[model samples]
Target: MARPTVFLIQIFAIFGFLHLGFGAPISLENPLLRQELDKVGELPGQNFVVNFTHYSGYVTVNEDSGRALFYWFFEAVEDSSDKPLVLWLNGGPGCSSIAFGEAIEIGPLLINADGKSLRWNPYSWNEVANVLFLDSPVGVGFSYSNTSSDLMNNGDKRTAEDSLVFLLKWLERFPQFKGRDFYITGESYGGHYIPQLSQAIVRNNLLSKEKSINLKGYMVGNALFDDHYDHVGVFEFLWSTGLISDQTFKQLNQVCANQSFVHPSESCDEVLEMVDKEIGNIDPYSIFTPPCSDLSSNRLRSRMHRIGRVGERYDPCTEKHAVAYFNLPEVQQALHVDPKYAPSKWDTCSDFVNLNWKDSAGSVLDIYRELIQAGLRIWVFSGDTDSILPITSTRYSIDALNLPVIGHWRAWYDNDQVGGWIQEYEGLNLVSVRGAGHEVPLHKPKQALQLIKAFLAGNALPALQLHSDT
Candidate 1:
């Protein structure tokens, strides 16, 4: 394929996958639009030196519905062409990965305290892999739909289908990434997105005469998986950590047992609401971290509440900075956002999408089983300080798999200090990030970087030293 240096695309994702019929491409390419439109140079109020390549734009997944997913891609600091491609999504079932993943977690820079300025992130994930941040499922961040109806009717299956389609179209835009090793990564609700999308990719590859995505494996941290196990573990951690009284814990267990994360029983909701009042103004997602504000007492914003955007629920104030930065006309223009298509105001998460989330799998454990059997590199990590999707819950969820142990459980080290604990299973691995919260990278970026590097290399976390100053 010739490099059409003169053209950039507003990708209308015509191609389909995973139970959707494939459509022929339409001749709607705009040759006058240069790829420079997508290349992000210095951003508005950027104070740090720009050193590497990054681009932000949209990939239209449904032309008929005018639905497009926004993405931000960053090349590795060095030897970018050789690094594996890693796609990062943030869960919520409706959250903006740009807001959480790129703005604060692992993107090249952090939105500064001033809300409009930027500073360097020494621990950005792009240092290791060619990172891609996607605002998926339409109506997320800069991603939008001309058809308002599309926003209300989104679910796991369509999200996966649209995402796979987005990937297919996006690969066309940057043909250089064609066969590079790719991995899907996210957390919270991504317990469903990652596995389901991986299933779509695997099945799609099996169907393609020539293989498409060079999918190696994936990793998820502080993820949501089993409904029963996850729900049970959240309460147990609260009880063990003394966040809830023993009597309250017993009451919760009695009332909330068998309650689905998405649809709790009336008794369960009443008990949870009571417990929310019990926890007070502290962030449930990161128990030890001082919450930036007290906006969530009315309704616990954590997944413990009806909302699924657990990862960023605790981060009310921090996200405001991102929202301010991304919403700026200059910032959006710099990122090539078409104002006509973008929302009047940029938001970090969408309540409408969450409220209308049509389908959510109760457990991705079966998909996990299938992927593990397919020999995908699967690892699940947890932040020990998180009460929402606590490490205990992740352990219980993974334990339900009942796989044989390959590597014994032990402590892992980073910089002569205990970073976390780890255990390797026959087909999957589990890790617990010490002293970290729900958003592992936001709280412990150095450790998160080490974890990502290990995951990309398929190596275990660094072993503890024989003799250490403990």
Candidate 2:
């Protein structure tokens, strides 16, 4: 088993000035702000990094009851004003976007062999658009609150509300980017996060004419969109790939097709057991470990399992590494985490952070429908080899949408070499990354970058031939 890695927690300190009533206005003139501004420079892949100097001391969700906190990381090309801002979140219901920033997509540097210091990535996302990676809701990453209750109870509703407040505060901090286009993108559980946040943005847009956040589009990669389709797809994929025996496939098909079946019941136990065994045997790196050995029992006890242990507690304001490499003396000094490698436990996904607010009724497909109706562009891409949220599951999810196909499934190529396949439907597009796993950018950076570039440019993906079935 891969050694456990600590989840790095990153939080921004609110300071400078207060505008009161409306919210706190961060002063760019603060000394720490000045220091951060001075630290701004070119990161790997020629991307410009500006430690967002704005302060968000306190965000009040309501005058009487609701409130949350957040911090932002902004990256862009130097002196470029017309680019769009893309808000990126990482799923975990508790994972930090900073983790995604450092390990997979963008930021500035990568953790070296020593675990500390920076390395370069030539294909960072900031090359095309301004990116804002946030640690949000309240306790994930660097965001925090004095109220202990705030740390323990949060769900999708609270997440969406806090995210909206953060966006508003962000706009207030960087007024120049207010009128610019904004897009929400994330992976894994973020598949849920982006849509919920987008829906909230739309509602706010409709409610307030004077102040509207112009949300352009949203995308999810290897995201959990629809539970029913996603679950079924996993079974089909295992069978089709010859990972399961023909007899097992037949048995599973019959069980799934039965219309009388209901969730959280004992009748489905045998099928679920088969699934757990197959999944565990096939891919040991299940992002969220299965709750029980019996699949039916796991599904029925999903709520209990989902609320698994929250790891060691550390101050949100403190800089800690989720992985040992990040906490190395060299890393701490280089990354600017305090105490320089002082053996601190990392919480990549905090169990203490409440996510009970996510409407149990809401499915990934439900959010997708809302986005389509709201006229928001959507893209769902998958890394073919990812067992966690495989391409088959994504295709299955899209099929249920019954989205009208604008273009048939065809190959996407680079340098005349077959790269992957693309299927265009209305405002939504689905593409596969050849040879990529759960983390596409990390696995196939060039292909991933090409796809992102084409999507951002609003161009149809180029056609390449599909791999022949021998």
Candidate 3:
């Protein structure tokens, strides 16, 4: 069933955008979105000097509603001006990219245990690309909207539209990045953000030559592409990993049939409760890692509800550092965060936005088809140990596309050791990271760096040999 969506039309009207029927983003006024004004002079607890410059500020997406999306842009570590620009998003549809993308995963700095200092990420993606991390929608991180209704109304369409508008305005602030090779990368729900935004860029690029965005390609890891496939993958991962019994597995398939993603049935919830009790406190996001034993059910429930089971953090209490660090007045001041905003404290994920997400396209596979056909460099990867959105789910979703096998399954290398397995499809490549969980870089930073290098260079992951099965 198609969504009764007039969101694009509504947004077009809001921005006075000419409806090209493909969500084209034209330059619009952003009174606060200016160049150099948003630059970060120094952080609250930084001890080391750096060559690259970075900025943190908001780009007003909707003037009528006062919706501004926050962003943290980091120039490349070396040859800063020459590198490609990579926009990173971390998805909960409501998660903070500044928290996950910038602080925890790919960003240059990691919050210290003291929650006041920072350490450099040796394998930060900025080594090769200028990375931009955004806190999208109105309610996530420092991004906010004055209208209360905006908080309750956000869904996929609005999020994508706002993000495209953000990029349009953002490029104006950093015109040096205007025609650079651009790529978007993220994990989990970013699965939706990257493709949808890519489609918008591709379609809008057709309207004008001077304003076109130079989008080269994009990638996602352990992403949520399709709900049906995801649900199937979850139950199967649970059973295969011995987290649930055989009988319970059968019950999950039966009682949970046709129930997937955010829309779960009553019977499915009941089944999940049983599975939850069986799984206990172990982190479902990474079965091998220890769970964050400190967080309350209130703060942790967002992920728990993602796959019908309780999940803890990949890094035990790592977000506490980010939460503590980002919420400080000094840090906020340094980042150019506007003081007046709803929900005063900073959090990694927004439960309000998650609960009220009004509309979500169930699958991005079709969007992938369109982008793939358009010759966009597309790649999907999985952190295999992530039972939350497992490798199995990625596999099932990719298989559903029925794309031609470009290369047989092969072992990809990092430092001559088997980092993971990879298989290439007609336009998409799927790679799995061994011993990695939902946050691939956090668990396997070196390998993650290698993966990014391959994807960005339009080169394949270094391989041992093709598998005999193909």
The digit string of per-residue lDDT tens for model 2 on 18-79 reads 23235465455443343343232332222334433222133344444444443344456443
Full-model lDDT, candidate 1: 0.81
Count of clashing residue pairs in every prediction: 0, 16, 0
> Which of the two candidates, 1 or 2, achieves a greater TM-score against the reference?
1
> lDDT of each prediction vs. the true structure?
0.81, 0.59, 0.81
lDDT of 1 at 419: 94
User: Candidate 2 lDDT (Cα, whole model)?
Assistant: 0.59
lDDT of 1 by residue, 104-145 (tens): 899988887678888888999999999999998887788889
- Which pairs of residues collide in model 1? none
Best by TM-score: 1
For model 3, what is the error of residue 416's alpha carbon versus the real structure, in angstroms, after optimal superposition? 2.1
* C-alpha RMSD of candidate 1: 5.7
TM-score of 2: 0.73
